[model samples]
Target: MGTPQTVLHVDDDPEMLALSTATFHQFDDISLLTATTAIDALDIVSSHSVDCVVSDSLMLPDGVPLIEALRRENKDVPIVLFTAKDWTEVADVASAAAVSEYVQKAGPDDLSTVLEHVGMLVDGDRDESLAAGVSAVTEALADHADAASAASFSLDENWELVGQWVGDDELGIVVVEAIEAHAGLPAIEEPLYDYIDADALEELLRPVLEDEERPGIEVRFPYGDFELAVTSTGDIFARPEPGETLY
Candidate 1:
């Protein structure tokens, strides 16, 4: 690892900050920095070239406000909301701020999720490949405007099915189908509601895609064994969950 990825973790709790410091030590590629308040975090970000920011929702000024402030400092820096609060509590505000990812704090294992996202968001190697795949998928959709059903394309050797082009009316259906296809299930045996709230996902995505102000923003979430990346241009890409190998 040449220049290690710099990650700034913000939380008012000393225990949580210590926990994050210890957790990040497990990875050689990450250089972790801790800030107990949004002010210090912003200072750290402005001084250093931070790759990602992981913050708690219940900080002195709240996580979303910190995110907004960080956006002013650096518009494209990946910010992850690592909070113990329920997602519903901060989903709207976080979405509006364009948080790169959200991980609910549960057990110690949840820190691993935050680490995975940090790696995913900061990995420059993957960005080029993902951008290429998105471009191909967008062009394919443009070429086949008359198609009625969702079409899937392989993203890479690791991905089973990558891209789907469907209008807003069929986005949920295509997403469900993509998940089922990637998991090799005839149908989702578990309740569909158990995976993710389709309505909420659509609601979260509509404004991001429709808004001309925010360009090149993509919303990513874990869906079953796959991670779905919904782009600002109405393209969806699914691949194996981070750190998971598909057999």
Candidate 2:
């Protein structure tokens, strides 16, 4: 058989690297390289061919942002952000950077799933084909709500929400109401609220009605069991805690 594909695992934590190495070892068709720093990992990438890079968002010693550093070396290389929480913050940056994938730094099983997807993509699997099977199902569910009508929120000068999204259902009305309530004024265009954050976005919501005439409200999402407080400046933001489930 040909040599196994190589996966570079980069993180500042030694235990995480060791655990990942042991986990991937179960698959005989894979080889792993562990790096404790972004510089060392970049060196490895320059010297050896790497199929995928599983990295942390933050590494020590100048604390190079993992995604930014990876983009400099290899833009096309598939990178997975292994993090504890703050999915919104990472997702926002990743989306802007067009990252390949992201997985929570929770369990070995989650890591395994991330590895499996990366391996398949690197091994010449079509992205659409791989995503189609699952994306279709998710899209179908998403069809339950109009994307145009999706909820939003108002933010403050610091981009913090003064309240939360409150409504009868998952429809965008909730988000609209939430923003309306916090802004104390009607949204410019649609009824739905807006999303804003400095690092991570924790809540998606509907603004409240008569926001200006009433006190700030706190909207809650039953799906993730998270809440948000919309501010008056039309910016809604949240700071995620480690180990918090975003989705």
Per-residue accuracy of model 2 over 1-247 as CA lDDT, tens digit each: 4567788888876535644554455455668898877788888988988888887876436755666777778878888777786788678667754677778865434655666576675675433333433333233223212221233323334333332322224434444454454445543253233433312222332222212232233333221222343332122334333355433
- TM-score of candidate 1 on Cα atoms, chains taken together: 0.48
The stretch of ten residues in a row with the least summed lDDT in candidate 2 is 140-149
Clashing pairs in 1: none
How far out, in Å, is residue 36 in model 2? 1.0
What's the TM-score of every candidate structure? Answer: 0.48, 0.47
Q: How many steric clashes does model 1 contain?
A: 0
Model 2: residues with Cα > 4 Å off, grouped in runs: 59-64, 124-247
Report backbone clashes per prediction: 0, 38
Strongest candidate by lDDT? 1
Tens-place lDDT per residue, model 1, 184-228, is 776346544676686666665432112123234455667766677
Q: Who wins the TM-score comparison?
A: 1
